[model samples]
Target: MVERVVATEEAIQLINKLKSIHGPLMFHQSGGCCDGSSPMCYQEGELKVGASDVLLGHIGGSPFYIAADQYAYWKHTQLIIDVVNGRGGMFSLEGPEGKRFLTRSRVFTEEERKELQL
Candidate 1:
C-alpha cells in the first residue's frame, strides 16, 4: 500500500521532540487564509475532526488529515511534510519551536495512481 503523506527525517525528528513534550500528536491540512494551509500539528484530539475531515494517512506515528474539500484538491499528489526555519501557523504547535512544518507535493505517476486506484 502507498502512503499519501510522509515526513522527512528532519521533520520526524522535530515531531519526536514535540511528542516528547506534548505526548501524541496529529496533523491537519486546511485552506484557511494565512498559513492555515500549512500542516498544523496538534496534540491528538486538541482539535476536533468532524465529518468534513478526511484521513490522508500518518506521519511519525501520528494521523494526518485534511478537510474533505481540501483533500479533493490534493488527492492527486503525495504530500511531503518537511520542517523549515521560521514560524509555523499561528495556531500550529510548531510555531514556538522556531521551525515550521512545510508541505511539499509531487504528482502521482501513472503507475502510482493506478496502484492507489486514483
Candidate 2:
C-alpha cells in the first residue's frame, strides 16, 4: 500500500527524540502564513483535529494530518517530512532544538494516483 505521508530517517530520528521527551506526538500541516505553512508537531491532543482535517498517514507512529482545505491544494502529491537545521514553526516542538521539521513533496505518478484512488 502507498502511504500519503512518510518521513526520512533523519526526521524519524527527530521524531523519536521529541517523543522521548514529549510522549505521544502528532503532526499537522499548516495552511499558510505564520505557523500555518509548515508542519507542526504537537503532543497528541495538544492540537485538535476537527472534521476539516484529513489524516494523511502515520510517520514514526505519529498521526499526520492536513487541513481539508489545504489537502485540496496538495492532493496530487505525497508529503515527505524531513528535518533541517533551523528553527521550525514558532510553536512547533522542534523549534527549541535548533532544528525544524520540513515538508517536501513529489507529484504522484499516474500509477500511484490511480492506486490511491486520487
The true-versus-predicted C-alpha distance at residue 101 of model 1, in Å, is 0.3
Q: Give me the displacement of residue 91 in model 1, in angstroms.
A: 1.6
Stretches > 4 Å off in candidate 1: none
Top candidate on TM-score is 2
Put down candidate 2 lDDT per residue, 25-118, tens digits, no spaces.
Answer: 9999967887888899999999989999999999999999999999999999999999999888988999999999888999999999999898
Query: Tens digits of per-residue lDDT for model 1 on 72-96?
Result: 9999999999999998898888989
TM-score for all models, in order of appearance: 0.97, 0.97
lDDT score, candidate 1, position 22: 95
Candidate 2 residue pairs that clash: 30-36
- Model 1 Cα shift for residue 94 (angstroms): 1.0
Model 2: which ten-residue window has the lowest total lDDT?
Answer: 29-38
